[model samples]
Target: MTDSVALWFRTYHTAPAPRLRLVCFPHAGGAPTAYWSWARELPEDIEVLSACYPGRQDRLGDPYAPSVHAMADEIAAALAVLAADGVPLALFGHSMGSVVAHEVTLRLGAEHGVRPVRLFVSGSEAPHRREREESAAADDADFLAELRQLGHSSLADMDPGLLELVLPSIRGDNGWD
Candidate 1:
């Protein structure tokens, strides 16, 4: 990937000549680091690349993506560069990332002439089944409650300052202002 495209991804393992590239997208409020361990678990021939959404982690200073389509556009462009040499790709995503991944997959095929070998998604409904009106909690209190209710109790226990810094990205990802 070029230096410009590199900003959007974090490669945990640098394969000498990867047989395949596995691109991973994280859930809302998540960072690329969430998939870091996959680098060690997967075979050396499968290089693991994780998407790093802006406004969090290393990209903390950057603006949050305006919309899922915007995220998909940028991600698709980057993946096109990565796949230009014909390295096969497989996409994996969870929750909100699944939607982004699905969009990226479509863009890759239609706009870039690249089709991923596989798309593995979990913790999200099929793209067509998603409700357009659904959104994140209305307020911080409700958001925290929702997180806990969704089995993200760890987030509820996070330091208040840290949580504050991460909430905007989470809310933005879910289509909230």
Candidate 2:
């Protein structure tokens, strides 16, 4: 991989490379940049990489998938290539991303034949036991409340411009059941 690509997945806040890779998935409406600060808090022995889902960040030009399975499949394929080099890896995800992480981990194991060493899920319930099916596009008040409950201080603060930028992804992801 080129230096920039390598840095994108490997380096963390100018620290030494880690023996294990911790791939993170952000919540709905979240981006890879959200995890940048986490690099400093984690141990130097653990590498940190975050998922850059389509329709967000530099991938905004790409089409967004409408289902969790599709997202999981894509992630599995990418991680399959990464794992081929024999690097141990784990997963960490929050909120909607937790569902993506769980499904992607299964897809990785069954489809790609790669199992993560561990999985960390936060601010979300078990994927299999998820309650209700509320379309994100349908609910504005409740949806914003859910975002607040997920601990998105910035979303809770609700600056008009930021809200304009993030709401589309949130609404899109809500329909991703």
Compared with the true structure, the alpha-carbon lDDT of candidate 1 equals: 0.88
Q: Please write out the lDDT profile of model 1 over residues 18-41, one tens digit for every residue.
A: 999999999998999999999999
lDDT of each: 0.88, 0.77
Q: In angstroms, how far off is 83's CA in candidate 1?
A: 0.4
Q: How far is each candidate from the true structure, as Cα RMSD in Å?
A: 1.8, 3.5
Candidate 2 TM-score versus the reference: 0.81
When summed lDDT is taken over every stretch of 10 residues in candidate 1, the lowest stretch is: 128-137
TM-score for each predicted model, relative to the true structure: 0.92, 0.81
**What lDDT is obtained when candidate 2 is compared to the true structure?**
0.77
Q: Which pairs of residues have clashing backbones in candidate 1?
A: none
lDDT of 2 by residue, 7-122 (tens): 22433454355578889988887788879878889887777888877678876666677798887877777788777768788999998779888998999899988989999999
- Lowest summed-lDDT stretch of 10 residues in model 2? 2-11
